[model samples]
Target: MSNLQQQLNFVLEIDRLKAVYRQAMVKSDNNRFENSAEHSWHIALTAQILSPYAEDGVDLQRVTTMLLLHDIVEIDAGDTFAFADQTALDGQPEKELAAADRIFGLLPEQQFIEIKSLWLEFEAAQSIDAQYAKAIDRILPLLQNINNEGGSWVKHGVSKTQVIKRNQYLEKSAPKLWQFVLEQIELSVEKGWLKPE
Candidate 1:
């Protein structure tokens, strides 16, 4: 097939990301559960808006691209809830690698490598751009949960410890955002959405 056909096919396949619903809800939509596609778009926009706060001065374009493609693998590997058990996440890395191969491989060779590199960078979360991307990615879910009166935390009985544990990386990437999340966690407990312990 031609390169254009390959690009088009990849675009078409990625549309399936819309069907992969995440655990978090969208506050503006009457608490509707967010899909992977919506979550990806939101994070990319957030990266743009919050780039100034990135600790290491990331490349906004790279961070946004990473956010946009980060969850595309969910189309094949499925969405894993942050609070799910290890058994649920078992072999998830392998599944996502396979999905990335099949999905990104649909693009022209050069495009495939570049896109896949962004995905890998996001996964590693080591580079400045990737770290900022991860911080923003995580910040959104907390915002949604707080906006909906602790939507997922209340529903799943998620605890403050679990949340703090999962998000400690925020302190390194964006200290202010991490502080904001900490404040929200306190408020969530006061509101009876999260356990005080």
Candidate 2:
């Protein structure tokens, strides 16, 4: 196929991401589950809007690109809940890598490598760009849970400690956002939406 054709095919294939639902409920959608596509779009905008708060300087464009591409693998590997136990997470990286290989392979070789690299960078979360991108990624779900009265946290019986432990790296990359998260956790606990322990 021509490169354009391959790119178009890749675009069409990724449309399926919209159908891959996640655990968080959308506050405006009458509590319907958010899809990975919606999450990706939200976090891309989140990264852009929150770029100034990154602890280290980052290329906002690169961070946005990483956020947009990071979850495309969920098209095939499926969304794993952040609070899922270890058993539910076993072999998840392998599954996502395989999904990346196949789904990203649909693009022309140059585009495939470039896009896959962004996804891998986000996964690694080592670069300043990746770190900020990851901080933004975690922010939305926490907001979603808080907006929905601890949407997933309450449903899963999640505790304040668990939420903090899951998301504490935000303190390193985005201290302001981390502080906001801490306050939200306390509010959730006070509202009885999250377990005190």
Q: Whole-model Cα lDDT per candidate?
A: 0.88, 0.89
Best by lDDT: 2
Task: Name the 10 consecutive residues with the lowest summed lDDT in model 2.
Answer: 48-57
Clashes in predicted model 2:
0
User: Candidate 2, residues 1-197: lDDT per residue as tens digits?
Assistant: 99999999999999999999999888897889999998999999988788778876778999888888899899889999998999999999999999999999999999999999888988998887888888888888888888787788889999999888877768888889898899999989999999999
Kindly provide the TM-score of model 1 when superposed on the true structure, using C-alpha atoms.
0.95
C-alpha lDDT of residue 12 in model 2: 97
Q: Which regions of candidate 1 are displaced past 4 Å?
A: none
Per-residue C-alpha lDDT of model 1 across residues 1-197, encoded as one tens digit per residue: 99999999999999999999988887778767889998898889988887667786678888888889999999999999998989999999999999999999999999999999989989998887888888888888887788788888889898988888777768888888888889988888889888887
